[model samples]
Target: MPNDSPELNHEVTAPRAGTAREWELFVSEDATESPRHVGSVTAPTREAALERAELHVGRDAATLWLCPADEVTRRTAETAALSNR
Candidate 1:
């Protein structure tokens, strides 16, 4: 059976109750390079988040940083400041 005439749809939902907080992990392999976002961890507390981050994303990393996703501020292309061209 070949069924190729269908639409694929996806929906995003908010975090659940017990595990409500999400922490983003930043991975740095060298001192000369700035850390970059590697992955995310969902946990009820920061300690668990840190542990999860270290186990998941920091296995081979030099350093890892975990911050609450809600506390972190980000600037997208739409909200970023424009420089003189």
Candidate 2:
């Protein structure tokens, strides 16, 4: 089956909060499957972020989502909940 997701094709622009920010990149080749996190990119703008991510991880993506790294929850192997358990 093809992706029935709503189009999110609008141009994406990052907020100019600082010089540059790290954006976490996720790509979906099969929409029925959750998008995979290919890698991260540091860019001054969302357009730049998309460009960088595309350059790095192209062909495998049908849809992409860019999220600020600062906003994403992070847990190192040492500090992860598994460590406490």
Clashing pairs in 1: none
lDDT tens digits, residue span 1-85, model 2: 6665567644345654568988999888977878888888889888999899889887877788889888887677766767666
Runs in model 2 deviating more than 4 A are 1-18, 75-85
TM-score of each: 0.72, 0.61
Residue 73 of model 2 has an lDDT of: 77
For candidate 2, the C-alpha RMSD (Å) to the true structure equals 14.2
lDDT of 1 by residue, 3-85 (tens): 56545343235664554698989989977778999988889899988889988974678888899988888775667664432
Clashes of 2: 0
C-alpha lDDT of residue 43 in model 2: 95
Q: Residue 12 in candidate 1 has what lDDT?
A: 35
Cand. 2 TM to true fold: 0.61
Error of 1 at 71 (Å): 0.6
Angstrom error of the Cα, residue 15, model 2: value is 17
Clashing pairs in 2: none
